[model samples]
Target: MELSQNKRVADMNYFELIAWLGIGSSHPGGFPATKQNLAVLQILPDEYVLDAGCGSGLTACYLAKTIGCKVMGIDINSQMIEKARTRAEKEGVSHLVEFNIANVYDLPFPDNKFDIVIGESITVFLDKVKVYREFFRVLKPEGRIADLEMALLKELPVNLRHQMEDCFGAGTNPLSFEEWHNCLAEAGFQDVEIKNPQALKDNGNIVMNELKKDWVLIKDLTNKIKRQPTLLPRLQKNAGFMKRNRSYFGFGLIYGRKPTPVKLGFKDWVRQVIFRKKTNSSK
Candidate 1:
C-alpha cells in the first residue's frame, strides 16, 4: 500500500503510523507475550480461529503454521489487510490463513462460526463490552476468546489520562484486570479470567527488538522513517510516556469461553413437554 506523500506522519494516528510502517507486533509486550498467551490457548489443529484486529497477519499466520489451524484475520485498515495477505503468502500460510477488511463490532461472519477468537491491543482503543459481545456472538458454544490488552495496574491520574489519549488517540481506555474480566462475563462468557497478568516492562528498544527478527519489515520501516522523518519522534513520544508511566499499566490475556447449552434428559424433557402442554391449555 502506498502511503500518501501529502500526509505527514505527525498527523497520522497511532494505527495509521503502525500500518504504514508495517510493524508486525505493536501490542504491549510484543510478540514474546503473544507466544506466552498462545501456550495457554493450546489451540487444536482442526479448530477454526478468528484473529480480530490482526495487523499484518503475524499472529494469524503463526497459528496456521504452528498449530495447523485455519484462521480468518480481520482488520479495519485496508493497508493492514493488504500487508497481512502479503505476509501470509510470504510465510507459506496462505492456504490456511485468510485476511479481510472488517469491523470488529459488526463482523461479517455468521453466528457461532468460529471456535476461537483472538485480539491484541485492539479493545483498549474501543468499547470493551461491545466488542466482547460481538466476539461472543460469532463464537460457537464452548468457544474460547483470548484477548491480549493493556490493563491499568493502578488508578491513572487525570493529567496522565489526558496525556495518554494525546499519545495514543482519543478514547484509548485500558481497564483494570477485574474490569476486563467483568466485561467478558457481561458479554455472556463463562470462565472469564485474566491469565498471565504482569506489570509493564520498559524494554527501551521494544520496537527494534520485534522488528529485528523480521529483516524485511525492518527495511520497510527504515524506508518509512526516511520518507517521514517525523514518524520516529512521534513514536518516541508515545514510547517515552509508556516508559515513564509504566507503573500504572500492565497487560495480560483476557480469556473466556462461551457457555455450552444445557442438555435435558428424557424424564426432564417429558416434564417440560407436559408443563408446556398444560400452560398452553390454561392460556
Candidate 2:
C-alpha cells in the first residue's frame, strides 16, 4: 500500500502519517521504553509470542533475533505489514517471525494460542477494556500481556486534551496508571500492575535517541521527507504538543497475566457433588 504523493500530512490520520514515514517506534518513550519492558518480560526462546499492532516489525524481529522466540506480528494496516515482512527478511529472522494484516479486535487465531502478547502504543486509541478482552481471549492459561502505553500523570485540562487529540487523534485516550491497571483487571487479567512507570521527558531527545537506535527509520527518512514537504511540520506539531505538555504524560508497561483454570481431583469433585445436593435440599 503506497501513500498517495499528493496527499497532505494534515489530511492523513495519525496511523497513516506514521505508516507513510515508516517510523518503527512511534510510541511514548519510543524504542528505549520497549527495550526496558522487554528486559522485564524475560521471554523464553520456546514461547510463541504475538506482537499486536506491530509497526515495521522492529520489536518482533528483535525478539526473534535476540531471544530466538517464534513471533507472529499483526497490524491492521497493510503498509505496516508489508514493511514488517521486509524487515523480518532483511534482519534474517524470517524463519522466526511472521507478519500479517489483521485487526486486534478480532484476532484470527484460536483461543489460548499465544504464550505472550506484546503491544506498544496501540490500545490508547481504542476501547481499553475491549482491546484487553481480545488480548485475554487468545492468550494461553497464565499467559502474559505487556502493553507499553502512555499514562496520564494527572488530570488533563480540557484545552490541553483538545490539543492532544489534534496532535494524535480524536480517539487517543490515555488513562492514568490506576485506570490502566483496572482495564487489565476488568479484562480478567490477574496480577495486574504497571511496571517501569516514568514521566515524559524531552521529545527531541527521545526522537534522536530512537533514531540513533533505529537504522530502518533513519535509512528512508530523507526520501520520505523529500517526497512529502508537510512531513516535518506534522512531526513538529505532534512533538511540540508533547514537549509543551510533558508534565501531564508518562508511560509504563501495563503488565498482567491470564489466570490459569483450576482442575478438580476425583475426591474434590465427589465432595462438590455432595455439597451441592445438601445445599439444594436446604433451599
**TM match of model 2 to true structure:** 0.91
Candidate 2: C-alpha lDDT? 0.90
Candidates' lDDT values, in order?
A: 0.90, 0.90
Q: Write the per-residue lDDT of candidate 2 for residues 1-283, one digit (tens) a residue.
A: 4678788877998888878766679788887778889999999999999999998899999899999999999998888888889889889999999999899899999999999999999999999999999999999999999999999999999999999999888999999999999999999999998999999888583544565567677887777678778777877788888888899999999999999988999999999999999999999
- TM-scores, all candidates, are 0.91, 0.91
Cand. 1 Cα-lDDT: 0.90
lDDT tens string, model 1, 71-158? 9999998888888988898889999999999999999999999999999999999999999999999999999999999999999999
RMSD (Cα, Å) of model 2: 3.5
Worst 10 residues of 1 by lDDT: 207-216
Clashing pairs in 1: none
Clashes per candidate, residues 3 or more apart or on different chains: 0, 0
- Candidate 1 Cα outliers beyond 4 Å, as residue runs: 1-3, 263-283
